[model samples]
Target: MNKILIVSQQGLARSTLKTALYGEHIVIEAGSAAEAMARAQEYRPHLIVLDMDMGGENSAEICMTFKEHDATSYIPLILLSEQGQKDDIINGLHAGADDYITKPIDPIELLARIDTHLRTKEYFADLEKSDLLMLFELIDIISVTRNPKKILDIIVEKVSCYTEVSRCSIINIDIDGNLAVVASNDLKKNQKITLDLKNYPEIENALITKRPVVLEDLGSNPLMAAVKDKIKHIVNESIVVVPIIKKQNVIGTFFLRTVSTLKGDRAERMNKLCQIVANISGNALENAVLFETLQSNKNMLENLAIRDSLTGLYNHQYFYARFEEEFSRAERYASPLSCMFIDIDDFKKVNDTYGHIAGDLAIRKISLMLNQLLRKSDIAARYGGDEFVLILPSVDQAQARSLAERVMTMVREVSVPQLYGQRITVSIGLATYVNKNYTSYEELLHYADAAMYRAKSAGKDSIFVTG
Candidate 1:
């Protein structure tokens, strides 16, 4: 409720104005200007209905004093005067009185003026609250430490709390115009693949034009083609697609969907809110995309520094690093860790028979086959061309031998598409490091390398264990 201060000396006049305002506002009455000043500081009224003629001295002087004081300077002052003289009205306006009415005042006019000013203040307050909440929610989502997809999920959930946009989804468009849903508050379990826009060109055109597509009938609409099969009965409802733009180019779109069509004032109101959501979300999405892009690039570069580019497997240097890490972990936890050094059988002969390109392809295919067989915890690195190494943490001797056999089987079974050969095989040497058995990880690898030579001499495609 708006606080209103009434400065009038007569008890009768105060009671009359009290009845005029009634229950619509809280009225604070003061008999003298000094009392009014005190109440002005305390009440901080939205509008002050001041009687200039109440004090014995010139009323204009009191209005001028109210204007000079910072506490009452910006408060909307409605001057109440005994006479509406041109000179007195001019003086009142200069003294910061927004409007003046001659006393005895008309009740209807006073109520109308008070209602207008109070409504204006309320409008500003609502806008301020909306802005604060949006900033708070956006900051909360950005500060989260989970996966990138989780951030998109939080954004979708918070949009409903913001305004009347009941639901929102965040989608990302790849270079080929495939629409992949990054996050959605609704449909959390749905994992349908990319939406082909070629089948639904109207939605694409609407988004690119930067105009919202207000669909009254979805069954016949062009955009419905993209969403119809996925959501049953959704094509029969209304949809509003607001395109999210970044740097003048459209990145993705937000769906403001409803079960029924809105017309007249409601449609216009929703349209305005949609524009506001677009402006704010567009800027936010751009920043998120830029941050995510930089992060992805950093990860790509870090992996490249430690990975073999040709085979997309870890390099020999990474194997050394992992060996040290696993050795330290095994010693600390008192768990068993093992390694296997593998050498492809007759790789040189296979390369000479075909070409270096076929050799490269063979190595790549073998690497992939081994990867498909290994668990995610296992690390496979290309120790050198035609040779690889595997590190298994928390694995005993028996489990390591079993894992090595599975990898050999996978290598032998895989069919290389380009350079076909069924004679490809591998020789693997296994070594295990129990508690305190090896002082350094280098010695562990040395034992495994020795066993690898034993396997080569004994027979190809056979695993040999360290003594």
Candidate 2:
């Protein structure tokens, strides 16, 4: 039940108000300003009715006191004055009276005014509840995704939907004062655009103050004077920028623009919501940045473990591991698998004539050529210095020989500019597993290596195949 406090020195006036409000509300009466303040603080009434006649107790000052006190500030205050006391009525309202009733008070008008203020209070209460619920929902939704881009996108999308703004965006400002629109309601996810900080004076002010900046009228706001001409064509009439702060520093802002002019209670509510969201965004962005950094470090460590630092190909240990698995699969399924061993001819001569650096360059060039010629399923790795190995799945002897010929032709065509335009060649040996009774994949690799030595014996830059 709502509590109403009626302050009047006259017994007749207090009785009249109580009689009218008795059944609908619980009425508390105070005969003086001091007693009225005591009752107001004790009961914490939903509304206050103060008679301006106060027996010369400065009724307007009493009203101002109630409006200023934290406990009674939000309680609705109505002033009762004589019918023609225009100055008293004006003074009461100016002193923060929410409403007023005349000395010859009409019971119906009194009831109606009281009900209006009570309904407005209920509405503001509901709005506060709804805002809190929306904030919780937003936090829940953004917390489930680990992608930094998606998290920012969700924030702007939710804010835009709730605020119904012309534009809602999360902009990140770096230490260099560069602004980047990390996410926007109108843009695709992961799409970012750079913006000049000077163009957005409201955002710049918010960042400087580390507080929310609101401009209800862009045309009239002094902060927007510099950009007034540039934004003259824009239909938006209001803008709000709430800084997202982290560790006492302003990292970014929740930028919003709307066509409607937000003022009074509506503007205050919007500012409160955006400030709460900015606090939440700061924590969310921090977690996302940390997650991305950890994920990047993890991937870097994994790559270093399995990748050749020089050629960027799979290292020898990783190649052997994969070879074991592929050979087992091929044997189990009775599928054809080919292996090739390539040895660069006179690789030591290049190292001796030029340097080991040129030798490394030549090896890198051949590695690149192999990578370009091979299919996705083919695996190539540097088995050792100047010696490379390949494993081709689902390839027969004819296919393996064809691939070896191509590798020789490409390698012959490659000239090392560091070797003073000298061309180099490779001896390649191809071995295919069809019906061969190879005990293990190692046996197949041995056959290919033996054939490569035979190619070196016969002539350089030749391919030899072992049955």
Candidate 3:
């Protein structure tokens, strides 16, 4: 049912394969590598059995040429070499041989290898159809979510479920060009999981090739010699690294590590699924990143509207807006509401004598002291130039007057070192809402303003109270 190409320079080895494969397959024999390539181009055999020792180009070189050819790469090639040519066998495998058979090859063993490759091809064909359906499901999942953490979790979960790897991790390349584990499943405890592209040449190769890098066994790789002990201590067996590509750049990596060797069909399946997840996740991640940046910018713009530029206190407009809400709450609860109108004593003289910068420094210091002194529920705001307002929700006339005296003492002690140790003082006017007289916010504001004028007339640094 399948076409098999036998490539051997020796007539004896070629006849041996043809006799063994006779009626089972349509056996096509070639006596040399050149004839094998020409017949392979014409016949397009399902599999190739090449003799390693008796070849024009060595079996490994021929294997590499076959793998590099676009048309012949998919056709599985098994190398037949001498009994003790272990090095040549390894070289052949590295050159991309699907399987290897040794000379004095048993007829049953060689046929079994052929059957394995054929079955694997059939299994992969089925997996392709199923993988296509899975890809659509992944695309649908990406469409509904904008949260980056949520999306990454879904990716890790899906990859783990679809491909039964011992452990899986999605390593993100951050803005700083460092790799961090965004999501992982079944990661080893106490394992120092660190992967940098610079440190791992195999991983770097995967990124550059934009393809999967499969290391069937870490023990056999010379390139992994530097990190062999470290890898053996951690993963030790096999790892499949696939690059998550976006716009010709590797944004991240999908790593699957296992104790079992990943080879042939299993490796191909994992690589295919990795590419699917990488393609779908790249755009979803980008969208989530953009959304986070936009949200941060939006919050900053909203803060700019209500926050004072210099003192970092609430501005006059926002103070009025908050006052209305606090006033309504106090009225509904029948709570005592008090407001203090504070004016800096001789503020105009300070600005003229010390300069505007020193005046700003004084304002900032006062604001910082207010923030430290005020209760969480109390509101403090810069009403306008050289004046501030405080709203206390549950304070009566007696309490307001006591608080005002303490504030007067504190303001007098508030000296600005930047202004040559200039001491600042303030005149306070307090207004308490009486049960029926101060029914409206406007009435309370007017009473506080009147009290402030009275305090100014009586003395520059004093407190005046009105109900």
Candidate 2 worst ten-residue window by lDDT? 248-257
Q: What value does the lDDT take at residue 349 in candidate 2? A: 84
Give the per-residue lDDT digits (tens) of candidate 3, residues 222-297.
7677766667653445667766544222223343322335567677677656655775787777676556656868
- Runs of candidate 3 exceeding 4 Å displacement: 1-298
Q: Which portions of model 1 show Cα errors greater than 4 Å?
A: 1-297
How well does candidate 2 score on lDDT at residue 120? 51
Compute the lDDT of residue 52 as modeled in candidate 3: 91
Better of 1 and 2 by lDDT: 2
Each prediction's TM-score against the native? 0.38, 0.38, 0.37
TM-score-best of 2 and 3 = 2
Over the full model, what C-alpha lDDT does candidate 3 score relative to the true structure? 0.73
lDDT of candidate 1 over 301-348, digit per residue (tens) = 577579776577898888898889989999999999898898999988
How many pairs of residues collide in model 1?
A: 0
Candidate 2: C-alpha lDDT:
0.78
